[model samples]
Target: MTVLILGLLLFLGAHSVRIVADGWRSRTLARLGEGGWKGAYSVVSLVGFALIIWGFGLARQQPVLVWSPPTAMRHLNALFTLLAFILVAAAYVPRNQIKARLHHPMVLGVKLWAFGHLLATGTLADMVLFGAFLLWAVLDFRAARLRDRAQGTVYPPGTASGTVAAVVVGAVAWAVFALWLHAAWIGVAPLGRTF
Candidate 1:
């Protein structure tokens, strides 16, 4: 629990910098140059991510029940996760309608992903991890949108081809993760067995 809390703090704190202190982040980027700033950011993000993985694994070993979610919620979670994957794909596949509408598709994806996980799991560790991410995503998404508005940023129009590509890629990625990676890495099969 201690380790998990520490890891969450470090990870979330690093991520929250842009949302909380945009001016400071900009100043540091200017002072350090893009490459230097990227290097530092990568290092911190990696360390924090590693810690989060370790802590989450440890915390899961001693599961603390919070609330038992309904079986129907599992299906809902799957649907939400599917949507999330599409949104995430939109973030990379340029000129998609999803991305055009939601300037920050990645943040929206994070919000959906976190919400889906929260619905599926009901343990202290689950709540802590997913809830924190959900909260952060909401705040970060709002902040990012606000910044974009202030700058009068306009996202490019979407193309039908790009939208189709995004959907296909997102579906494939979601299938791969759900069928193989989730069970292999996380020790829990989201689709195979109901919890």
Candidate 2:
């Protein structure tokens, strides 16, 4: 639990610099130069991510039950996760309506993913892990929106073809992950069957 908390602090804290201290981040970036800043950031992120994986695995071994969620929550999580995948896809798919409207589809996707997992899982580890991410995403998204507004950011209008492509790519990726990769990687099959 301590390790998990530490990992979350390191990981989420690193991620929160832009949200909480944009000026400081800009100053540091200027001081360090792009390559140096990126190298340091990548090293910290990697270490933090590795620690999260290890600590999560350890915490799962000694399960601490919190509240038993209704079975329906799993189905809801599935739906949420599916949408999350689409939103994430929108972040990268050029001229997608989702991105054009949302302006920060990736952050929204993270928010959905964290919230969905929190709804479905019942354990201290789950709460800490998902809750941290949920809080972070909320703050990050708000900060990003504020920044965009301040910067006078303008998103391009989405094309029908690009929107369709994003949806198709997202759905296929979600299906592949939910059907096979979820069970293989996470050791839990949300849809009850795995390939």
Candidate 3:
């Protein structure tokens, strides 16, 4: 638990610099240069991520039950995760309506993912891991929107073709992950069957 909390602090702390200290981030970036800043950031992120995986795995072994969620919550989480995949896809698919409307589909996707996981799972470890991410996403999204407003950012209108592509790509990726990768990687199959 301590390790997990530490990992979350390090990971989320590194991620929150832009949200909490944009001016400092800009100044550091200028001083370090793009490559230097990115290299340092990547090292910290990777170490934090590795610690999260290790600590979470360790915490899961102890299995501290907080609450027993209804089975329906798992089903609801499936829907949320599916939509999360689509929103994440929209982040990359050029001219997609989801991105045009949302402006920050990736952060929104993270928010959905964390919230859905929180709904489905009820353990201290789950709460810490997903809750930290949920809080971070909320703050990051708000900060990004505020920055965009200050910068007068304008998103391009989405094309039908691009929108379709995002949906298709997202759905296929979600299916593949939910059907196979979830069970293989996470040791839990949300859909009950794994191919």
Best of the two (1, 2) by lDDT:
2
Candidate 3 TM-score to native: 0.98
lDDT value for candidate 2? 0.93
Better of 1 and 3 by lDDT: 3
Which of candidates 2 and 3 reaches a greater lDDT? Answer: 3
lDDT of 1: 0.89
Which portions of model 1 miss their true places by more than 4 Å?
A: 193-195
- Model 3: per-residue lDDT, tens digit, 105-139? 99999999999999999999999999999999999
**lDDT-based ranking:** 3, 2, 1
TM-score on alpha carbons, each prediction: 0.96, 0.98, 0.98
* Global lDDT of model 3: 0.94
> Each candidate: what lDDT?
0.89, 0.93, 0.94
RMSD of each: 1.8, 0.8, 0.7
Model 3 misplacement above 4 A? none
lDDT of 3 at 100: 93
